[model samples]
Target: MAEFKIVLSDRETGRSYKIDATGPAAGALIGRRIGEEIEGGVLGFAGYRIRITGASDRTGIPARRDLPGPARRRLLLSRGVGFHPVREGERRRKSVRGNEISADIVQVNAVVTQRGSKPLDEYFNRPEAAAE
Candidate 1:
């Protein structure tokens, strides 16, 4: 899979996530920019309405203005116009505007749940994981 970095931010709260795309979703997410949106996961399952504070590459995912159908709808709902982050477990039950995420937006859910992980900036800067 293609590897790239992601720097996400909250326009309202000023929080951010500095992520390394290690899966198939890498190229599809690069260069999204702040206030821009993308969709992931499933409709009923866990999902996100992210504003791209920063993106690393620009080859895979195209701009929202170029998308069509449900893909566009998902983007427009989660990322378009006035978008924000959803809560951890509320999922489809709660709207993005009403829910709150844990800590800073830069701390991705996966990375945070790992046995022992540091802050995104520190983890990226450091060489190894520390003890929990």
Candidate 2:
């Protein structure tokens, strides 16, 4: 089984979490969107949901091709010329040893959208019930 390290950050709270995934589904998260939701079983639980915010390879290169112009420029400048310049909406691909390597260690940045085996509504029977 191929293992992957997923680093998720809450966009609102700025809190981050590290999760380890081992399976084929984990590998399928490579090119997902920022707000896309994934099953928590990929992390461990069965009923939970994880929302992806950002993703990158192990080396820190982002998997998404929609970075802003300034951010893209900054990344390119920092990584030097070895990395090919990519336009907006264009993914970077490289060939090595007769194989195409896009990303080896995919670092998935996400947020826990849901948790536990029960529905979120079950936790709160009424609006007043959440006040306590």
Name the candidate that leads on lDDT.
2
Prediction 2 global C-alpha lDDT? 0.51
Give all candidates' CA lDDT scores.
0.33, 0.51
Tell me the deviation in Å of residue 19 in model 2: 1.5
Clash counts for the predictions, in order: 4, 0
Which parts of model 1 are misplaced by more than 4 Å? 30-36, 42-45, 53-132
Check candidate 2 and list the clashing pairs: none
